[model samples]
Target chain A: MKTPWNRFDFLLLPLLGGAFILLLWHLSSHSWSGDLPDPAKTWHESKPYVLEPWAKRGELDQGILRFTFLSLILVAKGYAIALILGTPIGFFLGLSPTFNKAFDPIIQILRPVSPLAWLPLGMVLFAKIKGINVTEVAALFTIALCSMWPTVLNTAVGVRAIPTDYLNVARVLKLSRWKTLTKVMIPATLPYMFTGFRLSLGIAWLVIVAAEMLTGRPGVGGFLWQQYNALVYEQIILCILTIGGVGFILDRLMSVIERRFKTI
Target chain B: MSAHLELFNLTKVYPSKKGPQTIVRDFNLQIPKGEFVSIIGHSGCGKSTVLMMVAGLTTVTSGGIILAGRELSGPGPDRGIVFQSPSLLPWMTARENVMLGINQVFFTATEQERAQIAEYYLSVVGLADFMDKRPAELSQGMRQRVGIARAFALKPKMLLLDEPFGMLDSLTRYELQQVLIDLWRRNQITTVMVTHDVDEALYLSDRVVCMTDGPEAGIGEILNVPLPRPRDRKAILELPEYHRLRATLIEFLEVRAHHRPNSSNSPSGAATPPASVPVSA
Candidate 1:
């Protein structure tokens, strides 16, 4: 078999792949999708988002980084809730077959439910907000509901997959139930939990965009929606690039956190 | 020596579609305190089952285990168990894995004392320099060394080793067995190890209990090792009694053990002990 990639061409191949995508985008804009600006034109128009990343003028208008920070805050809140609430539930599901039987079907039915569909329910659940906007509270609720499944499912799987030998070690040592959980269960399940967290984070990020679009925050999703409404496709390109870049950074940070835990 | 650990009519039966297949039937042994005991048998002869039952990792289907005048109910820190492959948590370093037990058993001890305890046992297992390395960073032998350290650090009343060096190469196994025997000599904790290695059984055990083939395996014969303490491998090899015992263990394994039923569902094959067993050393 022949390969397009050389054995040692790791970075060069990926860079070339990026160039190929740019060329396609440039070609597509020139022909079939004439309304959208080419990469060069879009880059010229979207330079301000890069030059001054954190700027705020109105409740609905902000620079890219400010919008990203808001999006990050929203995802962080929801992901924290998911990690806190969903992790224990997963531990139970893995440890107790009765609990798994009781909740597995419910989770399976709910896990694949479109995250956007949870938005209206989030709206109903948090209809009355004290200081914050109702839509903002609802959107927060939506992010939590949507992002928690991966963590819950992955944690359960991780728990189930813990080697019996480890459990035996726990037993043979007469580890108190709490110590067993903290030492044996948590450490063994962490890699899986992190996998779940990364996925949950991804979902949270995805949900925030849609939630912000509907809820009207000065976040990336909100900005992208605003650009769409204003027919400013060039700024939409900026939002896309910013969203991708931030998501990459978030994943990298998660890996760093995983490594940190691994040494403990 | 008076018995410190007693298994009276110990049995284990696992249920299958056909029936409840008995793995160990009416198996019995009594070990004095500070004794190193090995259960030697062919694979799947329920030697590990007996060890696990003693460790209380596996629930005893029938009968009871009495340890130090108390009826053993469930697994506790009093029994330190090392499995076939040491299952150290991938996230924790070797020191942390050892410390996991130290923190629990010695909860009242000072933080510094606990750290010292971990360091002390890790050094005993020859992992002083590698204590900071995680299980993933360690070799198979080194990881097993960590397991040994973790178990020994608990200061358990009994130590159970289920083929602790089963996964290691011949050289690694020999070195670890030496390490294990040295540790056992220091504390002389009542220990039960399951192994197929005749040399291992003879080297480390005060008594070697040969088990028959399974589906109802029980004690076939129990051999006492008259070999002196602080055993040297080459020195033991020179002793006439050592080779005789080794040959006997190897003989039981090759001849009598083959009578047990294969997985093909031949109950009749196992039912008739002293029947035709074609294999021999």
Candidate 2:
């Protein structure tokens, strides 16, 4: 019962759709002929930047690779902080109805606030805190805070959704609290926690870019803003493509890790 | 012989918006060691509630459950329970699911010995080939077999089953019933099963305890199955007593169903039987 769409068809369809869009963009640029840079012109202008991605010119003129690596570092730090803090808090909220009731309103109020809203507060708070530069600390804090919600909420939901039957099995076995937490709660909630992690990672990446752009930091978002200030449309287009491509790879990597955990 | 398991005037009351509603009333049952007892009643009859109380999974509002010489406090390793849903941890393999209980109960056993015990029980349930498979990869019957293997691996003093095959098709149910009977006969573990199937009750249990419907459901009758040992399904059906017992149980249920008030189906309505009848057998 093979359908018309085979594996090759599945791969070809999306590629064809992307090619069609590129063709349309090329035609529309030629026809309009305005401030928009033509595809050929942008490609020619950005060819050196693409080929020498890892070249170091200066702090602001760092290669695209350096900008990408810097952005990744910020994402990793913020996402790691969120993971370390959010997981246990989520488990606490899930396991205790009283805690959930007391804190749910606060989480609801704070979760939907824009990441940008925290920049000024974070800057002020981190200014006198210690070793790290105020702007960098504020950028990291904003990214971590904004990305923390999904992991917390999703982990709590996952823990709460554990089948009562599994808990009953834990009781019948008279498993120690620690054993139950590790064997039953953690494994049962892993999938949901990973879902939260995936979403949180995405948020971390998105927020880091915005945070870096506002803070005038050395990252992809900052590079894009700098290019925009200089009115270099070609570099801006290149940054957009690089950011999208990195985000796609990060999501795919998370999926691979998720599948590995699932099989166990 | 003295009772190995006893439920003394056990009762359960669940609080509602209206008031406290009693699901079980003055429930009394005693099972001697190594006896297989099946509790059968219509749906919403509180049979499962009674089993849960005995397993110490539910709070007993007014009575106590006694296992051996001690008063039951809460769920412990001494009583192994198999739920209607297989309830295996989907993430783990069949072998690991069974080993979970074995590791808890037999913590002192060496790793190899514990693994052997898990493998032994899984083999008993005809799941040797599927030991490494996850629950999702196996059929419903196989998953329940893994649950049975897990409970048996604990080597508990008592085994509690709440409609272990209620979700299976007829063929699978029959097959699993045979497997359970074989396991029970070999181990001679004290077992109490809650089910609504009369044939299933007669086939597997030494005694079948029937209950009136809820709310405030109580034990209606306890019938001793006089069928000989090593009973075969085909052979048991041929016996005259088999037909008599089936008819008697169905008649009691039919009478109750007819006299039940239309409102009795409500979650909190008390089931008032038109008349109380004595057990004929």
Candidate 3:
């Protein structure tokens, strides 16, 4: 309900939350957590990357912005594939009980698997390919495998939820099967597909971190893992912040798309 | 007039955990072209089922429906329906909702003509101003008008009305009935309406068929209203014949229709009146 908060409240309250978290971080760094950098010290340590985000000195020495963009691109590629495959599969699952029964067991088994688990399997699947960087492809594969379930599941659910009244209208109107599917079924199922897409995107962003870390692809997650090994605690914190900020932005973008289509 | 529509021995039985349930049995009716027919019965007496069976929306267990010399099966654009409640797609504008049916029925027509067809029907049903508005933006009566327009716009050979005004308030119901009669008079499409309201049946139908109480409902009595076309409610009330017909329908509904003792068990015992009745009765 709109009673929850005004738009202004949503904006200001999140800022307040950040401030509270910053205060806690500042106090904790000065006390029990000596190795962990405070907000100011972490900012000071990571100033070069923050100020010159376009800098790309080497394979792993790019600015935080570049790493974040790389992660975004990787997630986008996998998310697009997930939509292309998952949406139609979802339609089949939604429209045909036979298809639903056939694929249900496989989907249920695969849906809850961690990207961490899928990454190894992805490496094996792509390892045999020639002329392509296997690790990068594996990371993409892992992201797609982990992110596709929500879209597939949401689309099927949306199809199943179409009002019987509309179906009756289609039947009584003597609409051709193609017209019924395109005019009534597709438009009605679009909102659910969007919802699935939003969830798929969130999953893609989530998996991108683990995917990059395992595959050694140089996204923000790879940087974070590298900084941890190098004992550059401030850089690790900066990577973590970048991942959170980018994930938040991705979620917001997806919800806007979801809201636009849900009117159908 | 030659028979334009015929239903012979129409029956519907639904299997259940308890046993088989016969909702309708041995239903038969024949109407000449351009005739207006009404089936009146108590709630859950399967009146709508009979209408639906004719529309081909329901699977006939063991019977046949012949319209214009063609035996039809399954739902098609040849029969259009206006249900009691508004069933317009909420996401679409009234014109768009109407257009959904028009586009299918008039597929060979140009898009511009299709748009005009939707506009014309919406205007006929008094939705000219609100045609572009979505269902949620319109009042309840306005939405139902869109549904009526959609049905009529199909140019359906037979129009099936299933308690089309059952949900409306008295004032709105009166207004809609006027709108419906005006539309029906112009085209004279063979019509069958299922209604519980005696006044609706008398005011709308040329012949009213009363149904016996259900769990195996069958046709009980038929009353023919010899009132002239374009009949007005007040003018019809002034005639002695109108009052006599009205009283018989009312009396049948009030006393005779619900007085069945073994209707559920016998299917058609003394509780049901003979299928054939004298024109006066």
Candidate 4:
């Protein structure tokens, strides 16, 4: 009976707030509906899509869990490749002013283009060169293209911000160029590199959804689109909710990682 | 090896819109063995410029800088420099920063040897308890102590400092100055420091090189500090010669301060003195 804002009473607010929202949704679902489903009906109807994605395909080759796992793996692969290739290039670009100026216009023009635009080109190039199906390789390339921009840009900015006085210390100590770059430069730029990493993950997630939708892959986006077309309104809502929930989870996971490294 | 640092007619110039502005001109000095020389001047008198030139961070326009009887082409481990700022790597622990100098200068040493040297110097500066702490965790005075410890850990032929305690409060500066004097005496490391504090120069240095203001800055005079070893602070403050030398340095600085702004403004190319006054004979 205490006020909800009190310290011990605070725990009940979220539960009550959720029930209030659902009750309003239930009321509104019947307010003006010829085809609208209530929250209870939607939860029941969408349960299968969560529990069993394989039923739609007429085979058990892939399911919701399988597709989700595959997409996560692809994102990881693309990010790993980007990290290896982009960091060195970023370091070099950030260290030299002349090179930075020379390459800046190209980076500026290229960074803002949509990752989807590269999907068609990536499919063709990978299909012709690697003899692999276009969809799998195209998704990764598109993710890489999108995520590489922030990673490279942030790493370069961090490298450039290293104080000149630190460089003098390294020089007076006669630290070798390799030691200077590895021990001093890399550690100093680690925070910026992580910033790039977080940005790349967000970009990767965005591009993966788009790429799956474009390629008609058996993933969450494709399932969502298919459910919408089938006019299974309850299932469609569930699929949309699931996508948002997973994205939120991924972002939270990234924040945890960012927090751990933020001190550096 | 005995330290023999000599600046043979050292000069420095900065490019200006009109032409070139000279900072230090025809400045000649020599430090034999373990002399602790402090260069004192008002701001804009190119005192720090001289230190930078000696450290090989600044280019010498027309003179030679010799360290331990060898011409210095660039910065080397033979001369370690502690700057006004600690300049410790933010990510590194105090121990790591000190070890950076030790390892780089003595690459052939064993890991234990390197670590021991770093620890010994940290202990010398009374920072052994905070060895594992990062630069951010330490206070300003503590960080400067690490800077000093890092410089001395190299066991270099000479040490160059640029107003290393200029940023600290009076109490902290005085405390660190005493620590520095003790360390320099114990190690017998030849030292050159540039500062604007007359009392600091008087207290810490074997000789104080007072500089005049520039476009063409030159050494005003070198005052030989005759205070006995392990100097008593209160007793030195009471000495008449100490007050007399402090007055002479202050008066020389006041005259130079009035002329520096004029030279600084009159385009770099035009080198004109402002009502030139003769140095006391």
Candidate 5:
């Protein structure tokens, strides 16, 4: 039973809508009295940046690709640290009512606080570490702190929501604790954990951009800030588009991994 | 021989907001080896509770269960349970679900032997071709078959079924009943089933034990079905004793049981008997 809206319809509708928005932007920029760079002019000005994306001419004048790669590495490091630290904590919280009751309120209070708000504290803490790049460390800390909540909360919820029937089956089989944890608990909780991972990765990416911008690190967000200070509207628009594209790709990659590993 | 399975003064009391509520009170039953016994009663009569206690999935408030002269403490591989829901792990294939039980119970067996045992039981349940299918892909009947196969694959000394086919359609239910009977006959395991259907009890069990309604439900009657072995469904229906027994069971459930003279009516005493009228020929 094929419906009127098919796969092609879904694909074509979004593409058409994006094209319409681009056309409207081009028209509005051209008609407006202000110095909003028209689409054509912005494209022409940013052509060199796009073509030589991997070039590294200077610290602040690095190519767009180099900036994107640097930003991605920071996000990856922060996100990895968050996953390693948060997973076991979440598992324990999920398994024990006592732990959850004692700590859940603290988590709730911290979760809603913005990553940008922690920037000052991160800078102060990381500056005293003495060896590595302090600003980069601050940026990484901000990203990790912001992104760790989703994984913790989601893992806890997943563990708590395991169907009682599975536990009954475990009892009937008299499986050892290790076997129950590995075979039933882990496999059952994986889909929910992946959901948390996807959300955490998104938070990591978003936080890295803002953190780098504030810290003046050599990343895409820093490059955007430099361009903004230099009054380069075209480069700022280019940076926005690059960030959006990369974020979309990162989300898609997470989905691919999720599909590959999903057990239930 | 000593009783293969025995329950002595078993009870289950749940702590409620009002006070402690007794679901089952001082229940006792015994079954010899390879015998089939079915428990039937109105809903909320603690029939399933008794089955769970025997399976060691539920904590008994008082008393204990004995299997083959050993006092039962907790769930183990010696007993296998088929729950009302298929309860197959949805992520695993039918074969894998059965193999999980086989592997755990027969830990000393080689992987090849475990696989063979799983395959054999699945084939016995007429699911050989669909062994690789996940629970979601299979029909309800097929999924229940997988559960049955999983339980049987363990080769447990005793089997417990808690309304195993209560959710199935009549056709599927009849088919699975025959399959279960065949397996039970072949394996000769001491089996106890909880059911609401009188005809099903008569068809499959050596004895049918009826329970009164709860809070504090107890055994009302136990009727022995002395029909011959390998009983055909149509042939059994033709027997005069079959009609008489069915009428007696229904009379007790509908008229006599609900109007107990001295029984105190608790707030939760509105439990209804199952709507399983005998089908006419």
Candidate 6:
């Protein structure tokens, strides 16, 4: 059982891994066209595009900044909507077998439908509505629709997974239905709930990008598409990097929050 | 005068694929206020079924259970139950577990009162230091102590224990038994426990009821324990009366073991004892 690996081994493995990837990239691209940049050259070419904005401090590249900010806002809003709506639905589905049976088939049918397909319907519905801007609404709507599935499904599964003995103990103690749910059921199902939360968060990010790409909105996805059309490869790469970095940070923050609360 | 707890011809049956299988039938008993009674029987003797019926966790197929002259329809706060498994909420610390019922059931108590009550019970169960620890962090014995403390804090009219010490090691079981004895002596709460251990029955109860197994399990014998108060295990085992009672109980059980009816519609082989002098109850 005692293997050679330890914490230090894991920490060193990633560093060595990056260097190996860079070595392979350098070797493979040595004879290729200079047009297709190697890892180091790409890093060098992208450095100004990535860091110059922070170094000067007066909103470098308004198109990039605006779309990135707008995309994040939309994703957060959609995620909030999903969490609020999906949690109770998940709770009810988890608590009642009858409800779960009635809803399970419909959820399964709807969950697998592509987020891209929702774009045209979103546009059609929001076009006539004067007050709400259609593109933003469509992006948010698509994000919410796709993200809702996992949270609802996971929550219901979590609820159903609670041991019967715990419920019996709650019943014998004469705990009110509300108290039992809040104190016993919720805590028991929290880890599963968090799993659903993380999955739905990723779904929201994915759906938002696709939703923006399809809607042609002024977000990161839209900016990337514009850069592609204009043949601005550097700007396209910059947008991609920003999106990835933001998504990674958001996920890390969510995991930290989950860890803080997971004291069972 | 109100009976602290009364079971009048109570019976329980489970509906199976074939037909109804009875667990306990025509079971009648009364535990007076402040009395401690223990039930002893072999496995599958419906000892737990009787306790569940009294606790109102299971429905009675016939007859009724009365607590303080009021018939019980379902589970209520008046009867606290301690199960064999320490089903503590895993997410909650010991202090929170103890405080759970106290918050809702006794809403009139101030925060200070609740804390004092929880602390007092924790001290009684010797879990003062482990109050902040979760169930997972504590040993099995420590977790059971929290469970016992939580039940004590509820201040129910009667305590129904369904083999509460069955899962504990022998040493832990003995220590908890002493804690239970002290709590019982101090508070004088009516307690009825189902147990498989004969010594546990003899040591803890004022009266021990022996139950026979079958479709209609009922009291086969009742032994009124005349062992003096604060009896220790070593001291009690040395008594001639204790040895005689133990032997008599063993003989009665052996007889029951062989008396099951066979398929041939004839009396099964009897586990009859030798024609020795019978000890009068």
DockQ of each: 0.54, 0.65, 0.54, 0.62, 0.72, 0.44
Ordering by DockQ: 5, 2, 4, 3, 1, 6
Which pairs of residues collide in model 1?
A173-B77
Residues B1-281 of candidate 6 have per-residue lDDT tens digits of 46788889988888876567776767888889998898887788788989888877788899998898788887776777788998888888999988987886788989999999999999999998889999999999888889888888889888888898999999999999998889888888999999988788888988888787654577877788888988888999999888887776677676743332221233221322232422121
What is the lDDT for A54 in model 3? 73
- Which ten contiguous residues of candidate 5 chain B have the minimum total lDDT? B272-281
Badly placed stretches (over 4 Å) of model 6 are A1-12, A19-37, A54-67, A234-242, B1-3, B214-216, B251-281
> In model 2, how large is the Cα lDDT of residue B82?
89
How high is the CA lDDT of each candidate model? 0.85, 0.87, 0.86, 0.82, 0.87, 0.80
The list of candidate 5 runs beyond 4 A from truth reads A1-16, A19-35, A260-263, B259-281
Candidate 1 Cα misplacement greater than 4 A, ranges: A1-31, A47-50, A128-132, A259-264, B106-119, B228-230, B259-281
For DockQ, the strongest prediction is 5
Considering lDDT, where higher is better, how would the candidates rank from best to worst?
5, 2, 3, 1, 4, 6
**Interface C-alpha root-mean-square deviation, candidates in order:** 2.8, 2.1, 1.7, 1.4, 1.3, 1.9
Could you tell me which residue pairs clash in candidate 2?
Answer: none
Per residue, candidate 2 scores C-alpha lDDT tens digits across B198-256 of 99999998998988777777887788999998999999999999999999888767664
TM-score of each: 0.86, 0.91, 0.91, 0.89, 0.91, 0.86
Q: Which residue pairs of candidate 5 clash?
A: none
Encode model 1's per-residue lDDT on A1-264: one tens digit a residue.
Answer: 557666648888788899999999999999999998999999898887777778776776776788899889988887888888989998899989999999999988888877678888888876675676778778878888888998999999999998887887777667878888887888888888888888888888888888888877779989999999998999998898888888888889877876765543
Candidate 3's residue-wise lDDT over B1-281, tens digit each?
A: 36999999999988876567778888989999999999998898889999988888889999899999999899998887998777787778999999988888898999999999899989999988998899888888998899889999989898999999998898999999999999999988889999999888999899999987776677889999889878898898889988899899888877666543234443343433444532121
Q: Write the per-residue lDDT of candidate 1 for residues B1-281, one digit (tens) a residue.
A: 36999999998988887677888888888898998899999888899999888887789999999999999987888888888888887778899889888988999999999999999999989998999998888999999999888889999989989998899999999999988888888887889999888888898999999887776788878899999988898998999999898888888787766553332333443333443443232
Question: Where does model 3 sit among the CAPRI classes?
Answer: medium
Q: What is each model's TM-score for chain A?
A: 0.90, 0.92, 0.92, 0.83, 0.91, 0.82
Between prediction 2 and prediction 4, which has the larger TM-score? 2
